[model samples]
Target: MRIHVKLYATLRRYQPDLPRGAALLLAVPPGTTVNQVLQQLAIPDNVPLVTMVNSSVCRLDCVLAEGDTLNLFPPVAGG
Candidate 1:
């Protein structure tokens, strides 16, 4: 399946080779979960994942489907 991923905030640094704010097209096998995608992208396991699928918030265990658009943002903090 093919999915579009958008990395935001500090998470953008994870893929420095990719154009900032650009949607990345990834080809993943069937039954892939959000967590799996992040792992494949080299995102740290402990990093907080704020994810949205097609504009709705979803869990990391959410299964991905073809044409799914995923927007992922790492947890942000400020005082």
Candidate 2:
């Protein structure tokens, strides 16, 4: 299966070669979960991240599907 990944804010550093806001098309096996994708991308487990699947907030255990869009964002802080 294949899916699109978009990294926002500091999470973009995980894929430095990709242009900001570009969707990284990734080919993954069936039953791949958000946590697995995070590991595959070398994102640290301690990094506080917000995950979204197809625009809906989801947990790391969420299973991915072909053509699903996964958006990763770093923690947002404001005054």
- Strongest candidate by TM-score: 2
Count of backbone collisions in candidate 2: 0
Query: Model 1 over residues 38-61: C-alpha lDDT tens digits?
Result: 999999888887999999999989
What's the TM-score of every candidate structure? 0.90, 0.97
RMSD in angstroms, all models?
1.2, 0.6
Clashes of 1: 0
Candidate 1 worst ten-residue window by lDDT: 70-79
Clashing pairs in 2: none
Off by more than 4 A, model 2: none
